[model samples]
Target: MVGAPVPALRGKPITHRIPSYKLYFEYCPHGDLHDVIKAQVDEREVPVPRVRSPGGHMRVQKVRRADGRLVPRTNRTSNVPFHEGFVWRMFEALAKCAVAMERANVLHGDLCPTNILLGEHDPDRFAIWPTPKLSDFGSSRVIDAMVASRFTPPETMQMNFVPPELGVMRGDWEVDGLKVSHRTNVWQIGLVITCMMRLEFYLPETDWRTGPSSIHPNDELHFHDPNQRELHPHSFQHANCNYSPNLLALVRQCMRYDPARRPSPRALLQRIQARIPGSCGGMDTYTGDRNGSIPWNKTEKLRGLKKDNEWPLGDDAEVVDVF
Candidate 1:
């Protein structure tokens, strides 16, 4: 199989006497998947009114003429869901990456929205805008079933995106001989896609602890239990969007409770390809620059890092348009 189509390293690693190393990679101008999902969610919850300008360009409507008087403006929430085509394209791209990693015998212990970067939009080279590329290999490891059976998730790992098996383990590796495999990656990809579908950072009905913690410690286990229908994805209602049954079924298959039941990365890729109108034959080539200007401003970065309460909704939050 071809090598994983991850971000190309821009330069050689820099070594220091302090035993630290620095590596550079291609810059993704569109930020990460988290930013895209958050932008879509924000647009749905609080839409920005736009008007056609004299030049035939759509611009944000800052003011309106009412009864011969200028009014500040008005805004309303929208129920538009994310485009199904875009979701399919993203799923296909990430599936190719997952397949490559599996062929190379590598497991990305942490595969979440934040870890996936976006390349610039190239209409000529790619069918979809903003290609998704897997990034941040700090938590990746070579696959070894025997060794992985004794491994446990790190404290910094995002609990929400973790597989149900790892969540139940809870630092107890000796109790169960669960080997972290490609199925683990399947679960992560499913969770990420689910978040994109619901247009929320975390799953619906997630009980975030009242304290500083953003997620309840036992949330994953609770969702895994058959009796907890409220926290399960099957019970959660999707937005009024045209999501196909085939796509939804594929997601459910990937997130099955039994790891043995989940499809391999290659099989998942084939399923995603079948959904696309004209399969590109394989993964689409990303033509975006390896070193490009960073698109995010100060406010966007802050929003990505901190929770809603931590960052106040000031003028900056209101004025900034979703990317």
Candidate 2:
């Protein structure tokens, strides 16, 4: 994997409209960030995925010169096939990120593939991909809304990564406080893992009737009660797939109908670490460093980012308009 320098990182302050809370957040760096970009983004109460609130603004190298400037520029992940081992690594990184956010009383409500970025990427081939960094905190919440209906309903929820229980909430049932919780995050994580493991498990937007993706709506309409096992769809049809029994079981537990049954982030991390030895290692290990390497925090000095001065946008870095 080719290493690239992420010079700085920044977070902008944002205000929550519904609950009215001010938040300043940080991004999990996939590679070493030389300087912590201290620049504050423009203050706006508007809502937009990936760009809103404390998630901040970043100036990325729009293109790279492997040899010359003629080559096309590249970035990020989605619909990308991942090996089981690579997926496990990604899971570990995400679990660490999730634990950090939870400690700060934050919930990454949207944990879909679209929101995940591969730290180091090779557009040509996806062999042995880099550590995954969770991004797009637009839907994140300070308070746990899993059980409560503070957010919108599941049918109206357009994202593909939401847990089954979330997909079925409706009407007064939608307003119930117990609808979502930490377990909801657990379920979303499980779904992402499942998708990463078996791309076949990913539902084609056109053909939603088949496979595990279909289980949610089917379960919602026919198997409302968990006890009613007859019409309820089973998630584990992947016996033919290569995943070990232990990993498969973990995914099932996360996607459980009862949010109470899901594992806490700490517990989930332990489970993942147990399955994969030294899963939660430092930056060097994450960047595929085999030798025993010190943690990034101990060695790397963090420099504060100045909003205007630190990183002037490069000529090649054109801002893409976001709707």
Candidate 3:
């Protein structure tokens, strides 16, 4: 069996044992917000105690498996659309994550559907929503306006999700010092929400390429278009068709061309809380207040909640598991 082997420069191999799950749990105290289960890292007849690491010149970071299960993007099928309630919950997770990262002076440089992991409801803890955990911080960086300005964003970033200023650099562009601020994160969040809303109006594939219900040539469903490229004429036909007016307005504001116009991640969360009480851990006292208020349905409305692609088992859904 392959595992982390204790290494030593002399005598017996001294093992500085740390449970894989424990490390992640410590890294994120509010793990449940992302649907992460509080797992017992070490459970044996005789429990293992923590051991301090001896002074070593070199250090390494090793990855390990945990006991909880997660929902991969590949597993999601397109047959059934995500409900308004479930979509709101997903928005809550991503928005909260963005706000938390901003406060910690970190930027999740890469934000897309694949980097988001969904966890099943835990009956034991009364977690109802299939909570979304923002994962894969490989492209993350400590918040620095200067460093962020010089950043030539990764080409591999999902083009549809890339913010306009970052994606297209014009010679006459004015330097606003807010290039990669909380607003950038907001744009990404808006993209994900747009994609979910588009998915609700997804048309089934058929043999005919040109028809009323056939999938259009440019009906790219994976991610939302931030560039607003030449969209199909029928695209806006579904505009605010299934999504609430407020939800639609929020997404539009987030994807605004000017970064300064976008709301802060914290502001975004507060707006959602005002609209949908308890959607993101707020008191439900104002649920009855209706002056054009749309409530988030607490019912399970997700269908075809199965992976559609077969990617890796862990970490960015990139590498395949060999074991």
Backbone clash count, each prediction separately? 0, 12, 7
Q: Candidate 1: what lDDT?
A: 0.61
lDDT of 1 by residue, 1-323 (tens): 01235777764444556664455566566677787767655532233456799999976555657567655355554333555656776787789888988888877767888888776454543433566788887877777754367454433267566665555334443124456787878877887787777766666333231124454454433434455412355522255655777777788788776678888999999888776664332224333244432223211121232232443345654444221
Best by TM-score: 1
Cα lDDT of model 3 by residue, 1-323, tens digit: 00101111123333447422212211111232211111111121221222345774433333233755442212212223344555666676678887888888876766766666655442322144344667677777776765467465433244445554445333322233336676778877876676565543112321121235455535533122433332233432234336566676777777666777788999998887666643423322223234322232222333223332333244656543221
- CA lDDT, candidate 1, residue 27: 53
Provide the lowest-lDDT 10-residue window in model 2. Answer: 33-42
TM-score-sorted candidate list, best first: 1, 2, 3
Judge candidate 3 at residue 158 and give its lDDT. 49
- Candidates in order, TM-scores: namely 0.68, 0.53, 0.52
Cα error, candidate 2, residue 84 (Å): 2.0
Residue 218 in model 3: lDDT: 50
How far does residue 133 in candidate 1 sit from its true spot (Å)? 0.9
What is the Å distance of residue 320 in model 2 from its true position? 5.2
Give all candidate RMSDs, comma-separated: 9.4, 15.2, 18.9
Which is better, 1 or 3, measured by lDDT?
1
lDDT of 2 at 160: 52
